[model samples]
Target: MRKKRQDFHFTGENNMIRRLVATLREYIPSNRGYPLSVDDGFDETALCARLEERARKGEEASRMVRLREEKRLGELFEPESIVKHNLLKMVCIDEGCMPPYIVQSESMGGNAGTWGSFPCVGANFIYDRMGGKIEHFGNIQYAPRHLINGKFAEGTFKLACKIDFHSIPPSTQYRVVKTPSFTPATDIARQALEETVEQYNKIYGINLLR
Candidate 1:
């Protein structure tokens, strides 16, 4: 079988450098490539590696700051009370159909509770695939402010997510899920999310969120 290109998955700073130099080469007389690099005798390849290193270091620093400041209610796959799961209580509007309060996955990403029978899949983060979290914490149609993770002067508005409970059918929640994901067209939503991911890649010049 033919081997894959070595840089096929190097969607990082080096890839950026390659694009930048390639573009410059088109306009400049440097047939080899752009002479861009750190203050050293390093070639394009070496410069690419160094740029990637600095980019990684920057990401690490930002992640550290987030970890230090972000004291959230849950960890990955683990529901922490007052964080996401239990704090997000679901009361049924359809009486005699199901219990008033919906049971959440006691363990994060394990069972994810259930809508009567069908089980939930994947990590139970602040929000599911659909903008369920937004609906979860507010009466307004959409409240995506909570999606941002950082210190904000928004004050109580940041953590306050008092939303409405849905009187949706269990069967609907089981597979179709939320109105937007079920009513209009599920395939459409998936397509939109994917298209957005593609747009993101093009904007940032990186093949991620795929």
Candidate 2:
């Protein structure tokens, strides 16, 4: 029997859009896609209305783009690959708060390995924070080389999993959890990563290892 398709809905007002526009206007040059004039008068109701309208339009446009891309990818990759791509994309969405240089698994050539090999099916943090100071963070994977003390060096952290292609839907065998070492910085990063993963799994009725 063909399963009925379920529509995905946004849970609430996407405040990220508002926060992003505000942040971009501060750093991005006026000539580089942002408007030059800033509205000094703040109107909460009007702003909310405009933001809702923009979100509606943006969602429509995003759906069209996704459909086109999915159709194109369908020709080049297997169904499983497409599912993995979409799953990784959800993992990458910024929810207004995330560490810098964190990237999508697909961007790091995730799911590219051969059968039985561990594919990079998780997100990656490119750098680390030390003593609550981000400026002290380094890219080296070991301590002393990147840090003054003997403690662990903050380096690339991967939160990913291995998939068993033979597993049936809703089965625990589908995902094998691959966890990164725990550190103060990684503890914070893991919270953010898990939030997105949990939200996606709950909305889709899928079992994603947390």
Candidate 3:
């Protein structure tokens, strides 16, 4: 008798493994570039140097972005760094990328379907600025939100994300207790969006709106 294939559901552990693998893959450069191997008398030192130089150039090129990290992550802009590049591109929301389902925002987030032309929520990246399990982030909420009166709403947005500056080092992930930053979203309509944010946090485990 033929056996049936077992179906697997992606739980937290599976998701973590997927993210860890995805993160490691970034540092693994594509071998298609170098043609010479040991059989061709390749120099290990020269190859390592070439890889480093290529990675540095790639890192520098991506710094065109203007993120809120300007006040914090100035080191990444330096001429030398792999960590900076890693942090910048850590969250992969771009389409057709590896583990493409990992989302950094509502746009990249999974859709529960549409609600009267509005999109509903499905799955999303649960980032713990205290640097927890979630590695995917867009940092889109760092901007301040404006109220109808054109006043900058600070505290409400302050309830948003928690960026653990401490965990962004060579070791450790997130500790749950550390400094947090607020990613406020601007409402062009200039309406009070506190309730909206709260609901979003409660439903999707997002740091915003709560």
Best by TM-score: 2
Candidate number of the best lDDT: 2
lDDT of 1 at 24: 43
- Model 1: which residue pairs collide? 73-83, 105-113, 137-161, 137-163, 138-163
lDDT of 3 by residue, 132-194 (tens): 212232232533122112232222111122233567532111111111232433432122223
Tens-digit lDDT track of model 2 for 45-158: 455567677778867866665576557656654666423343334332222111112321133225423223333333333222222222221233422344544343333323
Error of 2 at 199 (Å): 29
Give the CA lDDT, 0 to 100, for residue 57 in model 3: 61
User: What lDDT would each prediction earn against the true structure?
Assistant: 0.32, 0.39, 0.31
Residue 9 of model 2: what lDDT? Answer: 29
Q: Report the CA-based lDDT of candidate 2 relative to the real structure.
A: 0.39
**Decreasing TM-score order of the candidates:** 2, 1, 3
In candidate 3, residue 56 scores what lDDT? Answer: 56
Report residue 23 deviation for candidate 2 (angstroms).
Answer: 12
Candidate 3 at 18: error in angstroms?
22
Whole-model alpha-carbon lDDT for candidate 3: 0.31
User: For candidate 1, lDDT tens digit of each residue in 182-201?
Assistant: 22224543453334223322
Q: Residue 197 of model 3: what lDDT?
A: 36
Error of 3 at 200 (Å): 15
